[model samples]
Target: MAITSANQLELLQTAEAVAREKMIDPALVVEAMEESLARAAKSRYGSEMDIRVSIDRKTGRATFTRVRTVVEDEELENYQAEMTVEQAKQYMANPAVGDQFVEEVPPVDMGRIAAQSAKQVILQKVREAERDRQYEEFKDRAGTIINGVVKREEYGNVIVDVGRGEGILRRNEKIGRESYRPNDRIRCYIKDVRREARGPQIFLSRTAPEFMAELFKMEVPEIYDGIIEIKAVARDPGSRAKIAVISYDNSIDPVGACVGMRGSRVQAVVNELQGEKIDIIPWNEDVPTFLVNALQPAEVSKVVLDEDAERIEVVVPDEQLSLAIGRRGQNVRLASQLTGLDIDIMTEEEESKRRQAEFEERTKLFQAALDVDEFFAQLLVSEGFTNLEEVAYVEIEELTVIDGVDDDTATELQARARDVLEEQAQRALAHARELGADDSLIEFEGLTPQMLEALAEDGVKTLEDFATCADWELAGGWTTDNGQRVKDDGILEKFDVSLEEAQSMVMTARVLLGWVDPEELEQGNEDEIDEDAVEASEDEA
Candidate 1:
């Protein structure tokens, strides 16, 4: 059967209805219909001829045309689709190249195969239009809440029917204690929206900490209006959670504000989380003060902070140690996470013992480094000289201030400490050379003896090996541990070579040896090095 002239208006009405049902612009359907008609009309009109169709929006009438553009003789790429201006002028007057002329073609009498092909084209276009519209609608909605009804479960993954689209909530995203059935209304956070070959997938989550934070934002007006704010949040799913908050207005209490009027606001969030306990603590600007608040219900008597290592040692009363650490260390772990520092909790007795051990270590170091008697060593250690570096670097006048130390004794102690350092450096260099370190590497200024030994073990025995070393290799963390080796994070973790110093050493070795050009390296050309960069290699050799 062929589609007759009487059915052309029906085609336009059908396209408009499908567009409305699919929630896409009707113009897309109209465009798809036009292409289908043009393809179907190809057999009647010549196959090589340019063909086009347009449907009137108001009257639902379709018109077909044979469109050919006028071109110069040299510009003729296709004889059937383009006509030379001389040929075009036979039909019209003063025609110029690049001008398009329309020739009327007969209406298409769409046969069974033609109508089937048009149907496939329309369906594909509508499906593609739906996916695009869905992507645009939900892409900006990520990290926000969306309400949907559970459609069904497939292999433990739940499908949801959001108002405008469908989404998937994987098993891992659901709270471990939560269960859902079909038609169950649920609120989920849109974690991501991805475009895939099948369709747009909107991924939802319920266990994300951001989801709980968002819930707080909705329940608390102070947070919403910026009176009080939530700083950080951590969750153990439905078991327990903690949130840190701070207030902008000095008179406002951040914790009281978050707890709400008789605990109304926080309770709403708690109910949603299935009775999970939440510790809402007031945030402090000082890390130590904030840490004290994070470890609520525990009393601290002492705090030793190591800012360089980002670690904190908190000393609690003996009876409070278990409470401070919490059941399974959860309390201290949460506090560490909230403070961004590694924390160690100990009782007062332990801290006292540790302090005594440190005193002995410092006293021994001074007695050996300065050739002092026991009483003098204790006097130096009590004055805060922990290592030989302090003894060698301190002013002779400052040393003379130590009780019973005369000017001559101070000068002799300083000279002896310096001599010991010089001897150590010489012995270290000799040991490195004996381990097969190349002369060129041995002469390098920045590398220490231990670094040379580490490199020698890895077969980087020559200056050329040092020059060819990547900045990462010099930066050190690449060794593996087995058998007698200890588990080390990186080579520099055991030594002291910083990445910046290693970078300088590698580049200087390469440039000084003429293995690379300073200007060539600067240009970053990698491929083109002028004669100068390469020519110096032999002279340095």
Candidate 2:
């Protein structure tokens, strides 16, 4: 009364039907049959025996057999044991010294045990094929948003049935405070699908930055058509997010389009994500402005970048400092991600104090050398101007206008300033000559003879010297032919010397001095030769 043979034919028919229905090849069934029958025979008979199993594809009927050799000596073993010549010749044609024989084995009954074995093989094949089919079905869906039912929640993980397979929504992957009941329909992003021993593993996430990107793709027509692009996204799920967006089309505003009318589109996404707030900012190539925009709803006074350290210090008003930092530093965190800067938020007062300290230090240095409050005075000294002659030729009126200098102090400092400017000019000329300028000064078109005299009086007697003068030095006192004064004009621009080229001129002058050979001074006409002394003779002539 064993049930093994009772439904053998019925089971075979069912396997065939399932294979055809699922598009699984029937050859696999035959393979399963062969494997099952071979195992069944091995179990019933000794494993040392050679077992052979074959199935007729058309009939689905399977046969199991064993092959054994014919040996003269009864003690000889093995399926192909040595046999007598007469016996070997009877089975093999032209039997020789190394020839063997093959005999067709009679089919076995495949009793209750074998039938049960075959049934198990069919079930395994069906399950494996189904798993493969499911993997193929879901792999193409990675990154797409899919609607699925939440089957259950266990230990903070929600198991969602995404049609062909189950996708796991881990604890962190769920939006904050978002609850799901069994059979609750929800939309989630397909993060990845991987093959596992049990089945195909599908990872679902509602917290991925791509979730926002995909949601935008669904709601914004511009983004869907590729006119507007979501350049980057930074999010704190169920709380806030910062997104940088750009548009390929000139007419389109990527942020505005994503927001929609009265924030309908973005709000729709927020609703889906359990009301997380979203900040959409315009992308910019400028790091400072981009950082400002990234830290939205919080006003930024300034962004000081520390390029070497890869950090940015953001200064905002004391009131906006907390806002810029956001709740638990979320705003700054998202902004940092968006702008790719390690941002440190500071109050305006803190930045002001830091700036004040730096100014005081520089002021101390300047005041230490000379009784002046002008930071530019320190800059002049750094440029090598230390005497009254150097200050006279180069303009110092502009220094008074900079932060922390007053008009009365500028007037008191004017003579000392002139001497310092002139000395800097002379030092600049010497430095330039050391860099290789042996020629007389190259007269720039606008510079008058009087200006040259004033520069010479300040000890700036050469082109090499003139080029060292800071631009702001020429911004005043030097009168145009129209009697108007040019202010902070870039002196290098007035002449044809690059600071490098000018330095070369100075170097050459220092090397040549008056000993400039004919070859060295071989550059101009007789009239130009007299150009350097022409000022002295102009009035007499």
How many clashing pairs per prediction, in order?
2, 34
Off by over 4 Å in 1: 1-5, 43-49, 69-101, 301-318, 344-358, 447-498, 514-541
Which residue pairs clash in candidate 1?
Answer: 477-490, 477-491
498-518 per-residue lDDT for model 1 (tens digits): 666667777889899998889
Error of 2 at 396 (Å): 17
Would you list the C-alpha lDDT of every candidate in the order shown?
A: 0.82, 0.72
Q: What's the lDDT for candidate 1?
A: 0.82
Weakest 10 consecutive residues, lDDT, candidate 1? 483-492
lDDT of 2 at 288: 90
- Point to the candidate with the largest lDDT: 1
Q: Write one digit per residue (lDDT tens) for candidate 2, span 1-541.
A: 1214454465467657878876676667657667767766676676776677776555545566665555555545564435655666767766655454545454555677677877798678777877888889899999999999999999989999887678999998988878899999989999999998998999999999999999999999999999998888999988899899989998888888999999999999989988889999998888898899999999998889966345788899999978898889899999988886678888989988987686566556556445664766566455555444444444566645555657766555665655555566676656545544434653443344444444555566665575555544443223245533333333343443344454444445544444345454455435566886797689778
Model 2: per-residue Cα lDDT at residue 394: 46
